[model samples]
Target: MNKPVNRHPFPGTPKRVGRVGAGRGFSAANSNTRISLPGRTLDVSAFAAPASHARPGNLGLNSDRLRAQMIQRLRNQGIQDERVLDAMMAVPRHVFVDEGLASRAYEDAALPIGQGQTISQPWVVARMISAMCENRVPVKVLEVGAGCGYQAAVLAQFVKEVHAVERIRGLYELARGHLRELKLQGRVRLSFGDGMLGLPNTAPFDAIVVAAAGIKIPQALLDQLAVGGRLIAPEGGAAQRLILIERTGPAAWHREELESVRFVPLRAGTQS
Candidate 1:
């Protein structure tokens, strides 16, 4: 994956927490490059690669030092699941952010991605995945927020199939292009519509992750989950935290508190 050069000449605390909801369509300026390990470059182009793009090294995509810094940042943020850590380490984050900010791809904070939306922090991505997984590698997964497709990429590693639903058209295509370049077109499928409505056709998901927090877990999502499926998400605003929902018996379910977290509020209806 591409490594970000960190220049902390002057540092300031994060101004805020939480995600910006998936509202309407928005455009993203994609300036992506391939990622690499130590000295080897990994080609990350998927369906999103643009023919007009420059060679990644010229675009600042890969470097041993940058990759290490990214791994360190995720580690410091407490992303400890070995599988998740490895996946996060292997996938290129720069491909999912604005090209101008690709250099900061591995930072432990969220960044804007137009459309009043933001790509989630890497740690947050790991945490939600780890929580729903229950220490087991996943099989089939459903992701409610496909912003930039970063989180979906993370889930695609362990799971057999990841059906990610995004509410906005532009972001959906943005993620689709990026995932394609990553060669993940076969592993991750992007659906553009009301995520709150859930993907009924592909229901019975082994694991469900809602990247955007909601006042309450949507009934549609719950109904779609397979028995024993796990759903993890942030459940409140101002005082957000992670909740794990598990399917027990037919129409029976259980809930567990996993961790405190903040994400954009889940919205209803569809975008035009």
Candidate 2:
């Protein structure tokens, strides 16, 4: 394995808020973003204007219906955190995907986002955040599989800070741009690297979320979690399960199964 790229400060300040403020909307700043996900650049801020009810973003999906459907799906799947629910609903999901796919953004399936990765659906995102803490502990969080940065943005409302890692270049740049569009880039930092190794500088995270699934939880992530910090991830390959692990002692951790989950595999390595 190679040394991972560190999570650097946002390329520039508001003096340079990337694609969103400039109106290009997440276009590559220096060069074209090279995300490893299996999709193309999202056509953001170009969809037909949304109806009056949900006027902020015109990404096709009705905001209320999307929120309700997500909540219902989560409840059926056993996600029960009001804070998480509110945050999930508050963040516009349609804005996260390409305009072409905006109509299906609220669906339960994970869709492709360039490279070989898919942004885990809203339900899964909410489930992971809800599973992190039952009560409002309000601690720092470690997020893997930055994907399109939607999950990290969802985590920002409930947690103090979110340190997220993305292995793909295009997706990473797009995610950073997404955060800035939502004014969340300040709350969440993006690391262009492998999710398997985890972000160590912001280690001992009060909560850890592996947006991508692996055969088992990555051991390095376990070692980096703060005691009492809850790590929620979808583990296993063919038969994936959402596992919740809590650090009990300096090196001891407790595990519990939440539910069955399927997610993109947590891939290894970083951009060269």
Query: For residue 134, what is the lDDT in candidate 1?
Result: 59
| Every model's TM-score | 0.75, 0.72
The per-model lDDT (C-alpha) reads: 0.63, 0.61
Cα deviation at 137, candidate 2, in Å, is: 2.1
Best by TM-score: 1
Off by over 4 Å in 2: 1-61
Candidate no. 1 TM-score: 0.75
In candidate 1, where is summed lDDT lowest over 10 consecutive residues?
A: 44-53
Measured by lDDT, the strongest candidate is 1
> Please, what are the lDDT tens digits per residue for candidate 2 over residues 200-271?
777878888765456667788887788878887766667655677778778677777654444445556765
Q: Give the Cα RMSD of candidate 1.
A: 10.1
Model 1 residue 129 CA deviation in Å = 0.7
